[model samples]
Target: MRQTPDCVLDRPSVDDLDQFFSIVSDPRVWTHLPSGRLTDEEEAEAILVRLVFADRGLTAAQLGARLA
Candidate 1:
């Protein structure tokens, strides 16, 4: 039988900050953001904090990314 994992997924831990930076650091994803590319690591960290903090009611927001 096929099963699904229905539990809510927790936010990625701080140890994964580099992965977070890769997302926010890209200018394309920041098209709606004022700062284009992330200011730096600290700024990227802040964005992560906010994303997990804000209750924008998205099961998942579709931000763009490219995997190489």
Candidate 2:
């Protein structure tokens, strides 16, 4: 895919948002956390709802090194 590289790489650009969630939220991709807790889909969905639609400007990476 092509990107203009204007928006921050760590943050979601409008175009890459759907593709990013499709990857990161996939059960097969997000396995055990470093703490060994498995992520649930409902939790992922809620997070996406908040971050993507709610216009919370914080990038997921800003949460911590783990998600980064």
Candidate 3:
């Protein structure tokens, strides 16, 4: 994690579950997404585990390849 006078930047983890859920479940977030907002904390946790945390093992090159 990196912190500066402006803000702190860090990867999402179990520790961020609550905040993550709050953000993901907000209707404002759905405005730009074709997908629906997360329904609850449980759903958020599942998404984080399946999508976010699962990507942590990849290297930059692997991530780039996946993106490509």
TM-score of each: 0.44, 0.32, 0.64
What are the per-residue Cα lDDT tens digits for candidate 3 across 14-36? 77888888889888989988378
lDDT of each: 0.63, 0.53, 0.76
Error of 1 at 55 (Å): 10
- What does the lDDT read for residue 21 in candidate 3? 89
- Give lDDT for model 3: 0.76
Error of 2 at 12 (Å): 6.0
Best by TM-score: 3
Give stretches of model 2 more than 4 Å off. Answer: 1-33, 36-38, 56-68
Higher lDDT: candidate 1 or 2? 1
lDDT of 2 by residue, 2-60 (tens): 45667434554445645655766566664664433334655545565556544656555
Tens-digit per-residue lDDT, 22-57, candidate 1: 887887788888567775999877567556535443
| Order of the predicted models by lDDT, top scorer first | 3, 1, 2
Cα deviation of 49, candidate 2, in Å: 0.6
Backbone N/Cα/C clashes per model: 0, 0, 0
Selected candidate, larger TM-score, 2 vs 3: 3
